[model samples]
Target: MAGPQRNNHKRPFGNSQKRTFGNSQKRSFGNSRHDQTNKKPKHGRQQMREIKRMGRRHQNEEAKEDFPDFPENDEGYESGDNIGEEPSGAMSLENNPRQAYDALMVLLDNGKDEKKTTKKSEKNTAKVQVIDGNIPGNEDEETEYGIEDIDEDEESVKKEDEEDQNDLSEDEEDEEDDEASSDPFEYHFANPQESILENFEQQVSKDSTLKWQSTKTSTSDKQYMAIGQSAPIEEQLSKGKQNIRLDGNLEQFKIKSRMNIPFDDANITNSQKLILDSVFKYKDVVFPYQHYKDESSIRDLYAAHAVNHIYKTRDRILKNNLKLSTYKEALEQGKASVEDEPELRDQSFNRPKVLILLPTRQACFAVGEKIIEISGLQTVENKKRFYAQYYSDDKVPEYKSNDFKYLFDGNSNDFFCLGMKFTRKTLKFYSAFNQSDIILASPLGLKAILEKKEKNKNNKDFLSSIEVFVVDQANSLQYQNWGNVSYILKHLNTIPENYSEDLDFSRIRMWAINNQFKYLRQNLVFGKFSTPEMNNLIGNKHSLNLSGKVKFKRNFTSDESGIGQIVFKLRQVFNRFECELPVNDPNARFNYFKTNIVPFLKEQSDDKEGGGALVYLPDYSDYLRVKNYLRYETSVNFCSLDEYSSQSKLTKYRDGFAKGKYKVMLYTERLHHYNRFEIKGVRNVVFYKCPSDETYYSEILLRFLGDSMMRDVIKDINLSVVKIMYSKWDANLLEKIVGTQRVPVLCFGSNEIYEFK
Candidate 1:
């Protein structure tokens, strides 16, 4: 550095010297550039102050344009004078790039205007001012400008966006209010406090005298009183003896054909009258009457109730429609106000309010006939087609049992669903379920519809509005498939997935809209006998009817038990097992039967004095397990018959077992229930589990043991033996078989075995 001092001379670009790019002019690059050689460039607060100064200058220029008399060289206009002064309403340049951008645009436009207007001599002056005003030296001002501007722009933009969103939301709310005010039916009302159940009770009480008469005079008696002795006296005086008698009989028949007569006019027994009163009062009833004999009267009572329900429902709907129409007309005529309009709620999800569940097509036909007769319809649409589909002309097979004969008398097809629509003077059969007033279906048929997958959902929507649910001959359903009945009940009175196109939301009852349809539904379950399954269904949570429920009690004495019908004098042994829980009873019973009963059965089969042993299992799963064990695990020669067995296979199994080719015959209760085949050559019977229907036990014994012809053929009456396996869970079955008096002794007794002859 000392050697270099020999060439010491004043440089043209000294710190004190000035330089210009365009012409001879002095220019300054602010304090940042001036102190760049000795000190670090200014940043943060100092730079921000400079930017704010530029913004103030822009504002001053705008003020000058507004007021031409304003001073240009004022203290506010001097950048240095206001360097330490806080900007008036100044936003930080780093936080608000919009202000900085405005400052920049103002500087550029001023420079262009000066260059265009001034002489070339003044061009350098304007250029120097523009460069000195904004340009920074020895620092990355471009990078700083970009970073600060981007951050400030993002924050400012977010604030603006939030403000816009708030404005839009307010506008949307205003529009919604406007729309609501314009439409009268758009507003939804809260659920009403008053229950419709009380209304039903009141109506029933008021109409008791007209609807429920207790008089003994029948419709025939009334007609006879009207005719007096005139008809009979005229018939006796007439010369055409046969024609006159026929005319008299025809008049009597006509009187009987009028089924729309009052309840007292029918030839209903006192017991039936008692049942009908409860039914008419909308009380749930479980009547275990002899269905074959009382079915006619029961059908008439329910049919009348169903028809009356339909009429009342339709009348309410029509009344509401009329009121709404009148209100609309008055409003158009300027005679009424919206406040004066009445509130009416009378509709459900769909039109079908009555469901009659039957066991077979024949039963459905009978219900349809009763409905028509009760409705007093002079015209029936599709009547012939319904008859052709449900009724059969084929000669019925000669069944040995009258119960079977009555059960399977007509078209016994179990899969059927029919819809009936009522008009002013006609009843329309085979209508769409959604358009029908009444639905008649078998459990199996309805279950199929419910389980079916459709492109459009809500296949069970038609069942959503069922108000009166009737299950006639429900005992027969247990033999078919009790699960189907449970499935149908599970889906009843549910909210629909899709509303009907014609549905009036304004007319929907508050209870229905609140999903309380099940509470208002009336259930009528009629059967020959009660089971735990039926009791469980009746006590289900969904069966909570607000009106009330009634279960007809059946008292059984030891003398009335089905066991008395058995003609065989052989000893019947009942073996009991212990289980802590009902769920474990099935497994425990199976194990005990395999360990103790199977060995005894094997020993009995080995004897040459008898044909073979028959083991009966009620549950299909138990049947399958025993079947697999006998076929694979055991060395027993056995033939089996279940619900799924083919006719040919069943015949082969029966013949082989009868001919002593098989040592044991495995029979399922369901098989006997569906086809009560006369199983012969069963010398020894072992009940793996008791049948649900107690009559089945007697039928099984009587068919094989009590048959004198079979006993004579086999000559093994004295060798015959019956063994039944039971547990506490079999109390229902035991009650029906051995009478109610013995149920407790057999179920809870200390002894594990009992014998009867």
Candidate 2:
């Protein structure tokens, strides 16, 4: 019996070729087996096969129910071919080979169909879970399948991962671009000309008041009137013809209405008005006679001057930028040509233009407060942090003198530096130096930064464009470190290095480009008293202000000098030394002291009645040289004291010298300046050089020689002798210590020595 009328049909597996299954070969539980008379069934095996077929049939029925829309005969088999029929007999493989082969093919088809049904069910379930916002687990399916199915799944998963990574990288790149664009330092300027033009346009559009329309006459058009004379009033009165008429001419010297003084007219004293006027004119000014009472007014005046300068500079640049922008816009619109473009060169190498050198943090705070007041800004960006750093609530000590109390009050901590940026409505403190409009720093602070840059061979570009330089409390700086201030001045207004990309070259001023900024820069120095150092600094080549310079003159009489303050009746001797060249003055003075004064001091130390000589040297270098000479070259028992001497060493040396253990004591003026030690048991006093601060000279004599305790112990104040050494270079110091009239006789007289009692 030929395999009962075979029904031919084809079914597709994955992507491979299709396979044909006849009705006798259909792999379903309900399919009927062919009736084979020549075949015999194995009863035990047939029973197990029947049970497995039944299980598969049940699973297919459930799959059909879950997806009722799926076609029942989609696998190319008749629906009736596998429904409601049982096997008639089991075919024996040894008796009927064709029948057994058909059975094996039927099993393979059934396995493929079951896999397809299960996959469809699982895929549909996953779709439902995803639509419900439930993520599927990463577990692999255990169902056996062809190799093609596994490869397809892996490719799909890899493509999804690649897409996810690309999306994440794109997002990160976008965030970085935004950050780079927002940060001014990191932002790369593609077209600086256009960028600055736009910036200027925005500034003007936001604040209409920035564009000033004034009818006041320009300073250039006004007649130049001498505000005040530098000569002493007595001398000016002596020459009656040269005396300035003060009748109605005072109005000409009055501050111009257009000068924009921040304080009220009544608040400013009459004495400060002329100084303010001179400063407003951008002239170099030296007010060495400034008193503590005048500090506030001086600070206010300079703050206003600095603010006005910044305003004018900003206005000029913005106005020029607007003009350039308009011209370019017109050209783009075909209404103007290249020749019609405006010339707008008004920038410098960097933005900082005002430099305020203060001695201490307290002074910086005062000046910064005045600047903020003058700016009329309601908000300061870092005001809280700035106050915490510069302001102090510490109680001041009860000093013996009011001057000392005032000088030491508040946060006197030095080594501070800060940069300020000004805007239309606000002021920002602690800005980067390169981006700041003003710099407030101590000399030491600036020196430290300069030294760091020097090691790297980098130029100080921030200081290259300074236009207004103010040094307040300059005398105080002399006490701290004058070399720091000198170093700062030497590096000002120099050409920058490797900073070309940071600036708009087309808009740089011709003067700045040619390194002629020093000529236009204004130098203002204020102090309590004048010194030779201050005079030399102001008169030096660095202070070449094109607007002219003025200095206040002070004259002194014998009674007004510090020498007259000495209480003890003792003989005072002045010795003059000659030096041919100014550069060789140090060596000449050292030699003269070594040859002439050292022997006198040695003899005094050897005398039992004379006691130890207290030798005072002003310059630290001189102190060091004298110290080394006395310690190594001389056999005299000596003790040295300086600013660097610690408390233990100071105590030990003071005790040793007072008890006559040491025959000589070498003292430095700086040590006395910082700590006014009232040393006991001092007899002969010798000055290696006149002190820069004349007060120190009187203080030492009064405290050491006129001490009541020492007087009672010694009982012979007249035996104490004071000797001083000087030179033509010390003329300024000598004039301040001994009256101005006496300086002429002492420095220029034929006598090399003068005696006074």
Candidate 3:
């Protein structure tokens, strides 16, 4: 039978080969021959077998659901494979031998009648296991043969968990339902709670509408009762009326007082009363000076000026057919471009400082104004400008201890001291007051405290720190005065009781040596002079000693001319002074010397434009150029209008009287910044100097003084010309060179000349 079976299997004519059990051999469960052959190679088959064995080891582990589809497939069998294919195929027997053998065993164990079908079913079971464990669903197939059955088990488990959860939830729900339905009223009735009793009373009051009580009186008693009850009430009412009348009287009195007017025998209008009330209510509120002046009755003097500003703005709007708001806005926007006003000079403020010695209160105020003005000056305007303000105790009005303190911070970094040539009496008084309680009460304003700050560290903070000495008892007088800073000065016993040889008290001698000339001089001292060692130290520190940047003229040889004496004096008087001006350029050096240094130097040369013989007016133009170079007014736009006019237009003109010559022609220096005093109708250029100081003063009502030749020469010019001089004021020399006129001379330091004429 086996031989015949083999022969029949090999032959196509055999019954087994020819016959089919429901087309079992021909049906492939839709899998093609190519698919089965390519299913797994020998190495892949071994890997798969190992994978299967490992999987069998974890069979007892709960079957995890298919991982959510990730779009990747690892199984050898791809999509479109028919599941009906059995292990009878040679490819399957090679891929998974164990699975094939199991299928064969199942077929063999079963009777021959079911052998073919049983083998197919076993193969299908193997495929299903791989699919369940590793493979994802077939998107085209929709449903698998055993997946529904597996899902049924999952559903039953899920249902069991949900039923258990429902049981717990039902119990909790039953308890909550009972608690919510419990009778709160029963607990209230069980105990006599105070809140509960109150609730009952409140409820009764809310619900009941009928009255609970009533009272009646006889006719005779009613009449007596009315009289007794109403009498006191009427009296009290009368008292209240009287009190209201008194209050009105008091209010009226207050209104009159606040208005600064007496209401006695005067008719007070309702409007005036209302105004008085409003003013009095907030009278204690502090306001700015401008606001205070506005609220007071004194601002009417400038009504016309204010009206002019308004009229100008209104005219702009009417001419432009624009809104008042728009015109005002434009005016405000344009204000920064206007030229600065000279009148604004009066409103200036100075850096907070202790006022040591000043000429007068008016002078102090003037200095304060100057300081404030300089403080607000444009950086370009401030270049090469040094301003000083000095005040004497005499200038200060009589006041309490804290009065001066109010002028400065208690711990201010700014200090004022005895200037270069202060009177001895003034110096001593200031030095004594500097150490007094009135000045020392607040450390804030003290020079010592100010010196601690970075900005003021190098400034002279002590009287002993100054190199120049003030003359004491030069024209000594025992004039005793009280109620000024002198009041505190008198109490100080710091002055020496006995004279010493080392201490110098030759005030008159030094004064005569410094100024050996006959002339009335306005006292003013500026800049510094240094001793030889001090000069060398500063020069070395600045690298100026070794530098070849500056070359002094060789005319003043061997220290014989007055130039050497001036240099020696300068070196002796000042220490550690640094030059901010450029000394390398001849013109610049000459200008610096003429404006600052030459003023102090003794007359040395008569030659024109050499050895300080002729002074050069600092061209404000150069300063403007430098200022422009320094980017002081970066926002200003400058345009040359030479095509149509010789003038140049500047969007803004930074102020401070400055002029300079380009080559030979003098030109006004524009700030390249907005002006504060400029109005549309007013000329930007004003007060061009007249020919002579006398003529100039005659025109502007200003005091004039200077050499007649220089004055006469500059009189006709429309530009403000500042004269430069290097000679010490001497009456004989003045009459010989210029005129016999007694000119008002402004002296700077010991040897410098500065005259407005």
Candidate 4:
């Protein structure tokens, strides 16, 4: 029956071919054709069976969305047969059993999701962004499969994180490029030496007023201007830079001043121009003398010559046609006898446009004439004109300090002070006394008159009208017998005794004094030596700190209420020949005389430059000691301070040295102040002891060189300074003498020349 049944199942066409379904695969159509075993290999059937088992096992495990890598059905096999379809031909599976087996393996490698979701129904994929946190839409909100799904999700998240990191790196790179372009540090200076010379050639020298040879460079620290370096004054002024053209009427001449002269019209140096520009801008300025002469220092030039330019220019522009206008106002008000002139209205002040405060009558007269000359108003026709008035304590007749009550209450300006009695002067000065445009008055004159003048309405006439205020040689002013500058500033600002609507109010700058006046805005201060005492006038704690960067030289804070500051750049144009000799030996006295002290003396004595030397000791005891030491030990010949009997002799001695009459001039630093005589032709300024007041030490050195105002009288020879330092104190003082703020000590060798490290 089995055989018949086997026969009943149509035999497969290929021998040894077996086709089965559902546990019936043991039935085999058998034929042993050896060469062609014409039957499916046992291993092929085993591989198919293993694949089926694997499929079953995979079905039991959970399915996930994203897997790493897997094989594809297309790579495995290409079977033309489909499951559950009618058989196309008898099963001849032996033809290609290996390909069939591979297809089954492919099926087992991949699986269907447990909870079937359609392609369209599955969660939407989104672009992953590495925000502060993971993207909200797809990270936590999306549908997920199971445990394996979680693993796949984590891998996908890592890939997204890596991509986000790459994007962030790119953004950081862009930011870095922007920062590199934005913040930069480079430095430059506005005024170089070459630029200054070029400017001089183009503007300063070419101008009609200052027609010199465009400033020639000299090989030495001090420059020599042979007798006729600059063109003759007459030639420079023959064709005046500006023609005087004033309105014929005095009323038109006094048409509310509006100064319009450009800076180009003035004959001044660039440094002076800078100062004038600052003054016009209403800023206070300070000029520091380097304690010695240098090419950069223009303090004296600005003080004496440049200020004149400002005054002259202001007047020339505002009162144009000055040469055209005669004194018609004075003519209308007929002049009478001295007794019949208007009863002296004492203390009456016509607003002085520019106030120049000086220490001595000599300077006042000299500087007053200079201002007039520079104004181009010196001579109507070769005769000096009355431009600025000069008054002094000595020139004013002597008056008992307490006899003011007996004196007539006549206006001081109306009368010339003669023999301690007030008497009206020539009528030509009638308008001058009442109203001079420029005032060059001694501080003592102002101090004495203001003190005794009945403090009525016109007490502060000079100060009230001042537009520009300057104190030339302020060190001299404070050292001599004038009231302290602080007191002057305080008194100037103080409201006058009888200030009222009727009083002639001076024109104050609108920017300085506003409608809702809080304080003066643009009042300016000019000082050659800016002493610490100035702080009291401009507000104490708010004063500039010299220990820090000065007001003008560097970045400094000066936004206080009162005045503006003008600070000059202190520079070294020439190398200082510093001699840093150590004088602190145990045999200090004799060693000093033998090595430096006596040698320096002999060198000055033999120098044929017609220039003498100054020997400065710190105190009287040191002076005497050095004086005796020089005479007894070194045979050095020098003039001592005690030899002078009176001021006249002191003056003679000073002049004689300047004239080369003496080789050596010795004095204590005390005598430098007491015996104040202008000495020039100084070959060497020697220091035996360190200066107690270092600032004043600089002033003493300045005395050796003459100001442009007094240049004609000076020797105009080259200068050298020496110091015989004995101790650490001397070394520190030596540092100050070199005129540097940063380096405390300078290196100098036996050759007596500065060494740069």
Candidate 5:
């Protein structure tokens, strides 16, 4: 007993070994807390919660694919575990500098050597560097002027809490206390991380030096890191509400004859090289996905090298200015702004010089990264330039240039251009027009921004300087919203006259008169399905009336990537269309639904991979009819959007079918309006009705096709495409189903599986 009391397992140097930081199991540094008095960041707790939630959702997705035995109910989803998750991009993100540095700090002890090893300053990421209880940027604060900017009204919750403490009745206070204590999880909707990050976003918004710091209190046995230092801790969130920045020495953008950023040029396909050259030439060229001959991503190739061409143009302009070139020459070249008038010298400096629109938020940022990498912008002395900001649903971090940037220790005179993902919030964010350059927005995002600026009378001559306009997915863009396409076409490259006092034209790179820009932009639209209507959008693309200049419906067909003549063998379901079901006499759709769709789905109901029915109907009414038919007419496990409207519900249904939860997944094409889906690994692809637009022909097939997603997400399979062709309109889809030699094709019709002979 005495020996046990004096055990040799004593704490090292008399320090208790039991003490630990964060979870003993995970052995992370610790859950850190920042200066709450300055701004209560969502750092410690709320972030952990969101992280846990996101992890679970990812797990569920993988489990649904792997285990194939998880329950198919929405119970796990609705329990507040998985909802409102927008994937940032289709590709894996390159490692962020700040993220890598912070991760390194987490593994090291709080020894002074830790700081020395990571002493190099980073431009993009802010690190917490609290010393002697003094926080940077907090010493001058008297009141919370701009700590956080919530989407909610700008009222301060702290002031409200003060008022409550000062004037609330005793009974009211007591009742509030009881209610608060009743639910430990309940708190006001204020996102702690967002509020804390609000000022940081705003300060960093205008490209200020944001130094996020952390204080490490460490002894030999234990180390405690301040929450401020561990902030990525979280990602910038989803790409929708995200921001991006670009800061590099102008001198660094020189030519690297042999340097290629994402991939070497030799691996680049000839079609891709042609598109790249066309982009540089300001030619309106459409390179649809149909022309893809190699496995290489043409999108990456275009964005990477296109950025090089843009930089070349800008470098030429900068050198011209240095060489004392006449303002007229720079204006004629149309590469940058060069205001000669003294009055125009003081104008806003953050308008976009170029514009590119992609299909999603992630694409905007990913392309931006490629541009940055190829430009040799890996390191920079200053971090206060919000060079690139992607605007999405506020998920992507927006590059904000401080309107008060001059007041901060950042560049005030140098003009800045940000790259932002286009989100619905782009309509409301007032600073977008002033700060954006090389805008990367979807057509819908541009529409929202256009409408908001128009309604608010803040048309700041921002688009007048645009030199290039590129739409990456012209065909899919047309399918998503033809009206948005029209809206962009009507105003893009056109100089508007609604002047705003807030706009500082002098800061514009080539600030002449607002209406005096000499360049008519070159437009490049990529359309998978070539059509004359799309060509019209580029009408007079080189014209000054905001109409498109030269347009070419370039469908570069190569035998290697072509869907070969095998697709020509698609057979008509009937020897001819006979009135088998009289329902078509009154409702042609109903007869096809009963005669063609019903039987094919019934046959697939017994497949080992869960013979799930995937019906893509754009209209909600038709979705209901199919869903009802399956429910009442057959014993198939099926569900629909009858009452459920949330994406979580739809996800559950789709995932359930994939994991053997249901036999049918009735998805509406309308879901694309909210957010598109690329469902993978499903066994049967039944086309209830083919789309009128050939643009969507390949898209719809890819969505349900056995293997079109990421290379590793699902295994390749021989697909069985079930076609419902009761009428000629419906029968026309047979050609789309029996595609060319890119892959083998099989179609089920007339109670027979027809192989492309």
Candidate 6:
């Protein structure tokens, strides 16, 4: 085997191989001789390494031919795996060492030449793109690279192709947009609205089939909200007191319940009696369910309903000169009467007519059989004359049929002036003098006549029973002379000029009177049934006095007592009368129950000392229930003075404020003690309680005063001194203003600190 292998090697090298072996042996022999001579080995190891590198390069060339990504004959040094570099040289196997080296250098030069061409092309492309307003990629970068690098050319071409494709896609998008705009909706379509509507309807039908219930109504009837139908006043009252603990502190108030007023305490009036009776009679009955299940709430809806009807009736009566028939009714009656006479062509009954003329609200709303009796009159021409005749009729029974036309031409312009003055005086008397304490109808002369008529009813001689005479003919303002009255009267028979104004002022009296008479045949008078003035009157109106029939009284008892007796008797007679009081629903949940005590609690405070400062106001439903209960109790007892005697007092003080005594001592002491409280528009000092946290305390105090809505109505009210404890004072600087009151500072550790008056 050795002979064969040697022979093979010898065949390849021939005599040169043998000479090389012989030379290697001779060199070995010489090296051995030199070793003995101790000569140092020549430094040819690096040269040997270079020769081995050349051999590797040659082998790499053959490998390159089989690989596509690798270049074959570019340079002696192979290109690394890094991007963008040319090979330095190419290597070959068959050649003299020097010749091959020279060939490799030539290859390196060609690669260098090619790399420059590629770099210049890339620069030109970048410059061209930048000039065209496109972002240049690697335009400013010149990576340090060998000139002989050839591998970078392939990588550059590949990267450039990818960039070009991306740019083309972006450019193509712009072209597509232009094409679409030119072609419009050539490739798009939309369905018609009718189809969309049909779909919508289908969806709606699938979801819910019920139609929306109408919330609008043109009738004068009262409508109840669903929640109100089952809510009982008694149940609500019980709920109100259920949470009230006997040990809890009560809130102080300037105004107290009207029921707290004493009946025999001397300030009572016929109007007050009527109001009290009406309120009480219906108090327990406010919740119809209390008496009868499944009863309609329309009867007790808004408290204003009855008042509005009264106004409407008055308007109609005023407009029609006390005529009972409404315009429509008169027209129909005229047409029916004329049916017997074929040639009658007349629209004469179309004019508006008045049925009743009332000087005051209480007189119109008088709850008595007499009011009904008086209201039943069908026709009373010249309202003032009629009233005069009616009053005079008590003196002489013959005047029952007395025509008012004979005494005063029925059109005396002087009557208008007198009436105007009388109305103004009466209003002033009630508003400025009465101080809203007593009813306004018990003192009037009309009530006296009614009383006399009643007392004389059983007497054999009716003529002798007429004790009072019509001494004065108090006139009212004429139809045209009075600006305010005329303005209201003219519009009484028609709708208001504007809805917003209707929310404030009542309509002209004429329309109300006419409507009352026009709807006389109806269960409720038509004129009294509807009108813009009536709308507001029934909506949110405040009352000051009674109607013309009832009168206010100052004396508790009197010998003549005719007027007071008449009012009292009338109220007794009509105590069963019921009407709705329409009011806006309050913004709180109304719960009703008959529990022994209230049990609801919002939350408890963590602060031990200051926690007691917090309080909760009753809900509107609770308020209503409590009010009704109190009113009921008052009504049943006829608002007796004893009712309000001990626990609380609702005494009427005076119409206007009394003048201060202006005592020098008071000015120095008690008066000076007044820090700065405002009462009835005067600034006075008052000791006040303060809160722990002044900011939170103020917020809570403001709530007690009332909300913004309440404040709007209570315009004249102003606060000066709030009860404040002296203890919570954090700053000693405050002592300068408060003086030597020995107020508790923050160091005292009191519960609350309040503003001092």
Whole-model alpha-carbon lDDT for candidate 6 = 0.20
What are the per-residue Cα lDDT tens digits for candidate 3 across 44-120? 22222122221322321312121122112212222221122211101111122222222222222223323345555
Identify the candidate with maximal TM-score: 1
Of the two candidates 2 and 6, the one with more favorable TM-score, higher being better, is 2
Count of clashes, each model:
0, 0, 39, 14, 68, 89
Off by over 4 Å in 4: 1-268, 288-350, 360-362, 365-437, 453-467, 478-484, 504-666, 669-736, 739-742, 746-757
When sorted by TM-score, best at the front, the candidate numbers are 1, 2, 5, 4, 6, 3
Candidate 5 residue lDDT tens string, 1-757: 0001111111111001111111111112221322222553223222222111123233344434422433243332232112234321111000111111222222122222224433233211122211011333332221101111111111222233234333333322221211231121111110113343443334444653334333222222221111112112133323211111011111222333422456544555444544443343333444444432321356565565355444433333233333343455666788546554222121222245566665443344345556545545433211111121222222211221121111111111101122331111111111234334356556544544454312334443456556556666554454344555566666654555565444544344332343322222455666444444455544433222111123322222222222232232222222123453544522666565677677766666665553455665644456666677788888766655321233455456556665666766676553432234455445444544544334344454454453422433233333445343334333323333333221122222343333332
lDDT by residue for model 6 over 1-757, one digit each (tens)?
Answer: 0011111101110011111100011111111322322642222221211221234344445434422223233232222221111111000111112222322333333333334455667566434422221233221121111011112233433353355344434443322221121111111011112332333334444654323111221111122111101111121212222121111111111111111112221443322222232222111111111111111122221112232223232222233321223344666767545334222111111111111232222222222113223233232212332132122211112212121122211111110101100110011111111011111121111121122222213211111111011111111111101222223323222322223211212223221222221111111111101122222221112110010011111111222111122211111010011112223122111221111111211111121111111111112223345335434632211121111011111111000111111100001111111111111211111112121112223232343233321534223334222222122222221222232133234334342233222
By TM-score, is 5 or 6 better? 5
Q: Which ten residues in a row have the lowest lDDT in candidate 4?
A: 414-423
lDDT of 1 by residue, 593-666 (tens): 88988788678657665477889888767877889988897778789876444344565677777677887899
lDDT of 4 at 547: 10
Q: Model 5 segments beyond 4 Å from truth?
A: 1-268, 290-351, 376-437, 442-456, 473-491, 499-520, 527-591, 594-638, 641-665, 668-685, 690-721, 726-736, 740-757
Give per-residue CA lDDT, model 4, range 1-757, as digits (tens).
0011111111112122223322122222222223223443333223223322123223222111111112222121212221122111122121122322233332232222212444333322211221111223222231110001111123433453354344434433322211121111000011112332233334433563453222222212221111112222222211221111111111211111222222232344433433333333233344333222321224333333334323332332223222112234444566333333222111122234445565433344344444333333322210111211222222112321111111111111210110000011111111121133444554544443344323233544435534445565454444332233444554553333444453422233222132211121122333333444332223312221111111221111122100011121121111223333444332453356456567878887777665667776654445566777777876555666531123334444556676777778886553444323345655556666555445434454554533311554333322344454434324434434443232233333333334221
> Residue 208: error of model 1 in Å?
36
Against the hidden reference, what TM-scores do the models get?
0.64, 0.63, 0.13, 0.34, 0.43, 0.16
- Full-model lDDT, candidate 4: 0.33
Off by over 4 Å in 1: 1-266, 451-458, 708-716
* Model 3 poorest ten-residue lDDT run: 473-482
User: Each candidate: what lDDT?
Assistant: 0.57, 0.57, 0.20, 0.33, 0.36, 0.20
Show the lowest summed lDDT stretch of 10 residues, model 5: 8-17
Q: Over 4 Å off in model 2, which ranges?
A: 1-274, 290-293, 325-335, 395-403, 453-459, 500-502, 609-611, 708-711
Task: Select the stronger candidate by TM-score from 3 and 4.
Answer: 4
TM-score of 3: 0.13
